[model samples]
Target: MQQVYPQEPRPFVKWAGGKRQLLHELERNYPKKFDTYFEPFLGGGAVMFNLLAKHPDMKCHVSDLNSDLILTYVAIRDKVTEVIESLENHSKKYQKNTNFYYYHVRESEPTSQIEKVSKLIFLNKTCFNGLYRVNSKGKFNVPLGRYTNPNIVNKENLLTASRILQSSNLEFFCRDFETVLHDIKKGDFVYFDPPYQPVSNTANFTSYTSRNFTDDDLERLVNLAEKLDSIGCKVLLSNSKSKKVENSFSSSKWKIKEIQVNRAINSDSKKRTGHSEILVKNY
Candidate 1:
């Protein structure tokens, strides 16, 4: 029998707070039609890819605060062939001696775009819990994850993502969430998947980049969401179902819905239990 493949493009990397699990809930709340789609906190790009596949004709723009993460997306979109070749090289050496080679690759930082993206993907797959976290000095610092086989070179998926990005209507940016403020217009559908607010004193995990998403940042996002709502734009946001997140949105215009999301890929199996997340939206 011939093998079957999915035409839907999914996230290539595993981000800490990716929304692949909650996409169904999100889609249910998504605006029926909008002029454009904007995702400010494009981490693993799970939601972005899903939206692109569902709305190929929708004009979309996605961006992230992490330079390296954005570089990986750009490299995949522009130079996928070169990136795949580099990943193949890394995968071959990694398979030889996983422990020894993992540390070697983690320590070296490549300057070229393709190499840098490949390195990021390699470290992500091999890193502890597939987390894309960085240190205070802005370095990839996650330890190696224990995996018999970590699909480092997912060539077909990468090719599919590249083709999706090749769409003339889709655009990507490497900047802070505030960058989209000036360009967003009325009738646009904006989805904010900012880092989750820590649910408890000991559950903080918002370190995707050097600059953490502080409570003040969440406040800023709330203000922006309100502004977007005032301007006739539709806004949907997801964050931890904590007091901080709940207290941030006070407008009657926005409705909040709590939903449980899978733990997905956490190092601590104990902490991998399903948790609550809120979907706040302005329709």
Candidate 2:
């Protein structure tokens, strides 16, 4: 097999609130040397992918609570061919019965975790805006989007990601973010990108997947950052630069800096403008 290189170019999935733009800033602030990397709240994996592309030799440990999201990473790592085939089939089927899209989403149940993983990716590819949202009962509710050509699968990128994953002394798990603290030691770097505080009352979009990161969750994360800071491990976290958030970490030893990022989720495009976000770091 040909060795996969980090130079492989891949288009990112246009995810809501993705941080592809701020990756350079992250890289600039990241420590030049570290024993390992840990990303607990991996959303669309913009930071992780960028890190993998930049630091090909770095060992990584990544986790997320969403089973579907974690499975997509696993699928790319282990079952790329199967995932691509299923996505192509989904594209053909979706072209025919648009109504059946929601029908299958609500009714169909896969026998195994991988099958469910395939279904999740199928829906994510075809779903409106690539937004992952669920109803009160935790059912996917986003409608199909209008796109002439959707890269439902990217084989080369998937293969490259798998190769990077395989080469590292890596560990992937589906668990709560707080549990990750127990595994970190000195010289490790932890990057956190938890769901930001809602921009406004009507513009609330934090419900990415089923679990909501409440204020209490934010408090717990603050404690974790403090713990990591005390242990000599570098920690960098990002969140909305709201007054409440500032107060939440006001007493912490971490240094805070603000950066503006484009906000893409809103009914009116005019309202979807740049907003301030805080990058708390102890390096």
Candidate 3:
């Protein structure tokens, strides 16, 4: 299911701290040769799609703790046509009333896996600025977007993504990041894009889903990287360039490189700018 000339690349959803800009840098740092590719965080799948575009023959394994995100990938891989159709229907049903949209989104239920996947894609497409924010009760809480003609669904791109996914010997799972180590072997490449340590106490945005990756989780990730490095696997990780983060991984083996990344989540336009982030690698 390889396309001779795949269509222009696009991300399926808007993810906070998505790595669209870091793709090229990641490609450069990634080893030229590796047995398999694994990404544990898998937010918006920017890296996975970039890898598929560049290396069609490479085996890939991707997982995410968020079931909704994994379901979106599964939908793209298995039910592209149906999911696109459902997204279009959802876009048409969107009303100007914010409360109406919020309750409609909050009240909807899916009977099957496909329907559940469709609901996620629908909410993601119509939510405010495509933000995936949730309440303490685990309900989708993002408001309605003000776009007159949002590309709620891109059938061609989704179809192209489906073909790209089909070409590679890839596996998708919804699990904790720690589970990824079980499948990684020697000479494999593992890219970690965990929720970064916030730059300041007030800047914490680790709550991508209901669960938050805390400081302890970040330490655990460092340990995993050290273990992978010990076994001869190449590991690269990205996190906010904070003193706390630097102190956490300030050891002999991990090399840190600072890179600028856009910060678009803040309300203040000035604050919604680019800043430095650390790219920790075991070279």
Candidate 4:
């Protein structure tokens, strides 16, 4: 018998707060009707991919604050063959000397778009917890993971995502989240998956870019959501269950639903369990 594969494209990279596990709940909460779909904090793009798969004709605008990540998405969408070739080379060399090769790529910065994206993907696959973290100097600095075998290439998923990105009416941007306020229309649907408000002092891991997502940034996000709401746009936001987050979306206009999720990036396996996140929706 021939093998079967999923029709939908999955997220290419492992993001810090990826929502692959929360798709069902997110789908349930999607607004029954909307125009364009906008996702500003496009981390792993699990939600975007899911939405596009279900409604391929939807006009989608996805972006992120991380330029390197945006470049990765562009490269995969335009030059997937080149990306797969480069990943194959990295995989072969990594299998030979995992420790040295991993550090060499992590330490050496490549300038070309293809090399930059390929290096980012390779490091993300081999790094500790598949985390995309940066140092104060804006450098990729995550350590190596102890995996016996890492799926560096992931050719099928890349091809599927590339097809989705190319065939769909999608636009990419590398800008601040608030910029969406200028482009979004009244009936559009916007999903905000900003770096979750840290649940605890030590649980803070918002280093996807050099600048951390501070309390002020969270306040800005809430303000932006409110603005979107005032414009009559359908908005859905996913955030950690914290007092700050709870207080921000406490208005009667927003419906807050807490959903349990598994934190795959946590260093401590024990702490990954029993984590609850809130989905605040205005429809």
Tell me, by lDDT, which candidate is best.
4
Clashes of 1: 0
RMSD of candidate 3 to true structure, Å: 2.1
Each model's TM-score? 0.96, 0.90, 0.92, 0.97
For candidate 3, give the lDDT of residue 6. 54
User: What TM-score would you give candidate 2 relative to the actual structure?
Assistant: 0.90
lDDT per model vs. reference: 0.86, 0.75, 0.79, 0.91
Q: Select the stronger candidate by lDDT from 2 and 4.
A: 4
Cα lDDT of model 3 by residue, 1-283, tens digit: 5444355356788788788878778778888888989999998888888888877777998998888888778878888888777766666666455457645765787777766876777676666667777766667777676666667677788888887777648889999888878889999999999887887768877777787888788888878888898898988888889888788678988888998777766656688767899888878
List where candidate 2 sits over 4 angstroms from the true fold.
1-15
lDDT score, candidate 1, position 62: 89
Give the alpha carbon lDDT tens digit for every residue of 121-164 in model 1: 99988888888888899988888888999899999999999988
Give a tens-digit lDDT track for model 4, residues 1-283.
Answer: 3222358888989999999988988889999999999999999999999988777777999999999999999999999999999999999999999999999999987888999999999999999999999988898888999999999999999999998888548999999999998789899999999998887889888888989999999999989999899989999999999999999989999999989999999999998889999999987
